[model samples]
Target chain A: MAAIYSLYIINKSGGLIFYKDYGSKGRMDTNDSLRVASLWHSMHAISQQLSPTTGCSGIELLEADTFDLHCFQSLTGTKFFVVCEPGTQHMEALLKIIYELYTDYVLKNPFYEMEMPIRCELFDINLTQAIQKDRVALSGR
Target chain B: MQFFGGSEISPSPPTPTTAGNNAHMMYVFNRNGVCLLYREWNRPLHTLNPQQDHKLMFGLLFSLKSLTAKMDPTSAEKGNLGVPQLPGQGCSFHCFRTNTYKLSFMETPSGIKFILVTNPRTGDLRETLKYIYNLYVEYVAKNPLYTPGTPIRCELFNTALDQYVRSIA
Candidate 1:
């Protein structure tokens, strides 16, 4: 089964910084992806306000009949999320690895601007490798 | 455990317990996007006015429904985004969970949407939503004085809903 569908990274202010579709069945155009990202950002914020408790963060997981979206928001408010097949295991760990790759290859590069779209070739290579590794490991199991 | 040595990034917060007053609010929207009912049990913050809040919720559901349908992995016919989908026409989301709350949604074949916002740690609510739908059918839908597509004004329905929600929350 195709475990992962896509990955999205949104800036703190709800801008789409990075989006990649990982050979998923349904493909979204750039415009559609941007719209979805911002919509998710707004929904996340609204969830916080809708919460009746204090110190509530935004949405972490959205489970649909066909797909599941898992989100991880860093302390700095940058959001990393993955859309995967429903019941995909170890997504949280996968997201954490992706975040680490972002820090190493994207953030460490001097040319990478803050809050801008990630354009680092090294980051792309590393991310692809990490995801491929995950796929191989999962399939092996 | 300590993967990032000095970065501010940390693991997500621990999941909250399902105990206590988990139910925060609920919304009942008719087929035409009219809010048939809105109830609040434990909301602390109010960012938008009542009208705006209802609209936003409806809009979110609209976009999510289309997105999910468009992103259906098994289906080959990819429809245009933002197009309205009939209830149960495509793969739809059951619920979404944040750190604090979970939003459970169910749309009947008749197009009535039942949304329940509860604590994030709450378990599957498919059965609970169905039970609520049954309540609506009995008290609100069956009542002769209650008109369809109008805001729910039946006291019997409200009382029963409150009692049920209290039991779950």
Candidate 2:
């Protein structure tokens, strides 16, 4: 079944705080991934500037030929993005779920530092299990 | 406090007077964590002693770099996701932004770190920092009397930096 290729959560400062790759695979290096995250950050800022309205906004969806990218920004400016196949359904729901998981497991954890990359074992486990469940559900459909 | 709208700034320990000063402050640090040069204009931070503030800033950058390195998915042992990957030991990020202020950072290959504090509206300063690095090499490094790891005090370098910063501000 078609599924999410990967997920990336970038802090407001353009650092990759969290990342997870589901079954789908790729070989992008660390530096390349960092560059990609930063590029999205700059592009997000540029897009907001180029917008006709002068309100708080960001890139919610970016549809490409091979893959579909969905982005969600929290009120605090941190961004969460997911990469899935072009025809994937309800990816936004998955991004929302990730945000919720991040808030519950990462933010509430006393060990976590603000604005730093995420490094919580529970957060990682819960996120992986949740994604696995979603994949199973998608295949069962 | 966080909007990217036009920001009017005061020059040199942040003062009451409103003027243009994109390059509000500059700091230089060696690989050993020693501060080589610390310059500020209209500095808003007077409560924290200069020494304490510099130490805190350097600490912040060091910890942040370590954290970024650890979070990188492709750094090492990608096959195993359960272990803590904090020993990866490298990070590549340009700047970090807060609501009111933005801190731009540049690290030289030789391990010297240059940190610039500016308003959120300031443009990208990668080239500007490279130019400043050149100026440092020309004046400070070449001066026969100047010793390494000491505070930078080249009059020519200061004058050039002043003119350049004011132009951007």
Candidate 3:
């Protein structure tokens, strides 16, 4: 089964708060991650600026045949990213859990530097458990 | 300190009330060496304590959060309390401990009313909210020892709350 390679968090202002890549790391670097986060943030702001005024608040998600990109925003304007393989069901639930974890762990952590790499163990543990639960439900295990 | 459910532990003193009163009060029940507080909402909050006055409501809010674990448990605690539901909907579970005091707020769905859990004597909500939110932002949210989906009580959350409350009052 294809596994999640990493997770990243971007504040609304186009700053990176946390980023991490698992072993099978794609062609990504800290600089690339930061640039991507900034680009995404700018694009999101521009999209909202050009929106129909009432139809969309910001860029919700980007998807293709092979990969899926999910984003979530808090009332205070923080954003979270979840990249997953195509055809993953319950992506919304996964994002919700991740958002909750961020609020309770990363954002709540005293030592966490805003716009830095996400190194919190809780984030990893919860993500793993959440993925496992999904797999179990998916496989009826 | 024991951390449960992504919240910090507060060292603020308890606000005691007689079981006879209908107003909400914070309760802490001791078992073995651990203490558990019972948290709930009696009604909706009518207004946000003006941002300037939130410091006074901290301790009461923490006790409520500690008791309820931040879960809106009005329905779950209903049978236990033998109290009927509020007639419209459920109470929003919001409880947290700050560098100052523990604070809890319950706003009605309509946003017209609010219930502030506070020390029966001081009766402040603004202080509590500000302090608790600050704690979440500063200590609990920043601690590396904290894990998501698990309850919270890192030394940072506790020490910050204690120091804030003591310094203020």
Best-fitting candidate, scored by TM-score: 1
Residue A35's C-alpha lDDT in candidate 2? 65
TM-score-wise, the better of 1 and 3 is 1
Query: Model 2 — TM-score against the truth?
Result: 0.52
**How well does candidate 3 reproduce the true complex, by DockQ?**
0.01
**In candidate 1, how many Å is residue B47 off?**
2.7
Supply the TM-score for candidate 3. 0.41
List TM-scores for all candidates, in order: 0.88, 0.52, 0.41
Looking at candidate 2, what is the lDDT of residue B90? 52
**What lDDT would each prediction earn against the true structure?**
0.84, 0.66, 0.46
Q: After TM-score superposition, what is the CA distance of residue A89 in candidate 2 from its true location, in Å?
A: 21
Write model 2 residue lDDT over B39-138, tens digit each, in one string: 7764543545678767767766565454344333333433322232232235344565432344677778777888876655566677778888887888
> Model 2, which residues run further than 4 Å from truth?
A1-141, B1-19, B77-89
Interface RMSD of 3: 21.3
Q: Can you write out model 1's per-residue Cα lDDT over A1-141, one digit (the tens) per residue?
A: 667888999999999999998777655789878887887888788766766566667778889998899988877889999988887898888898999899899889999999999999999999999999999988999
State the DockQ, from 0 to 1, for candidate 2.
0.06
Cα lDDT of model 3 by residue, B44-115, tens digit: 222233221222233222232222221121123322111223313323234322222233354322221122
